[model samples]
Target: MEELEAELAQLSGKLELARESLKRLRITRETVTEVLAEMEPEMPVVAVDAGPPRSGERVVSAYAGAERRVIGVLTVPNWQPGMMPDVLPSAYRDIVEVVADAPGPIRAKQIVPRIGLPAETGKIEGTRAKLKRLVERGWLDEEAPGLWACSPSSTACSGSCCG
Candidate 1:
């Protein structure tokens, strides 16, 4: 009976130590999360890059919709609204511009007329092909069959999924 009692006492002490270690682990996790949150940068900062903000250098602006970081400067033609086309073929660029302006996901058929392309069968098929390619290139997202929208990485568009 005394041996059994001694063993029980040792087991209880080990369990109590385990509980204290678990508590410390949880507290450490919470502290790491809080520190990460505090280190995050504010949204929508415009920083000038002319050796040190000269009087006339253009003040370029950028935004991070999520945890992604801006590693370097990216210059593209017509980056404002209704723009954001990279160095792509004119046909591909036109599709990007159209989708950027859309209030919601747009179908390939809808994009055809707006882009001044003919509504003929061949043109419609071509537009669908372009949209698929844009999805591959990460400039657009095809939310569903034939439906498309600009990707989050595209200028002026945000959100993880379809705009």
Candidate 2:
């Protein structure tokens, strides 16, 4: 009986070691995912296969660090020749400007001070709201939770010789 008890103790130690190894692996995975997201200049586009022909192009809408890549075809409505906003609202413009200037995704808190808003004034909520709306409008992409980055199209507009 004493021998069996000793063996059980050894197995428990091995089990604990395996769990620690798994935790390290998970952390590594998350870090790699964030790095990849930062490297991407625009949202990753993937070829999707589904349904009949659609008017607009199919786009990949998966968030960064997804455990299993969820591939789905999203048919853009309207399919307008030029859908870019001619003029963005002041607040929206400011937020997009910051995102465009950033080397990678910028968190809401980081943007607050840059935009001249007090970080402790609870005005960060306003920034977050605009970000979410911009993301929905395809002007920006949430590279990670609470991390904002400009879409490729928005960045292109900055270099235009529009006078």
Candidate 3:
């Protein structure tokens, strides 16, 4: 009974430490988010598909009172007809290409090394987040839990890559 009591005390102490660490992490995340919000440029609402620029053309936006071309915003856009992978940033385009070339549904771990990222937990999780974003934007498909594949409607998948 004494040994059990001692073990319970130790477990309680460890739990307290874990709770504190989690609180610190949450606070850090909130602080970083606030900082980023302050640093981001205010973008004007531009109508998409104005018919002046051709499909896949980079959109220009005002940044710091200077006009700058925005190639890829953080959020992925829904895949549209005539849209190409070129519109995505290099990293996202690489992911699409990798998924398009894959023989079947792939896991983030399998995609990490193929995309030249080290097979680390952070890299894998980051890639997984991108995969989820792609799926959310209709650029990719999640066939099963943690298994990602190219969306059938995506030009990347329907193009020569599928052949």
Clashes of each: 0, 0, 0
Clashing pairs in 3: none
Mind giving the per-residue lDDT tens digits that candidate 3 earns over 1-163?
Answer: 9999999999999999999998897676556444444543432222233335444334344333433333223545678877677666678888998988889999999999999999999999999999998998889999999999988888868876445
Error in Å for residue 108 of model 3: 0.3
Regions of model 1 farther than 4 Å from truth:
1-84, 156-163
The candidate scoring highest on lDDT is 3
User: Tens digits of per-residue lDDT for model 2 on 12-45?
Assistant: 9999999999889767755654554354433342
After superposition, candidate 2 runs with Cα above 4 Å error: 1-86, 155-158, 161-163
Give TM per candidate.
Answer: 0.44, 0.44, 0.56
Clashes of 1: 0
Cα lDDT tens digits, model 1, 3-108, are 9999999999999999999889767655644544444242223222335333422223344333322223332232344433545556776788788779989988
TM-score, model 1 to reference: 0.44
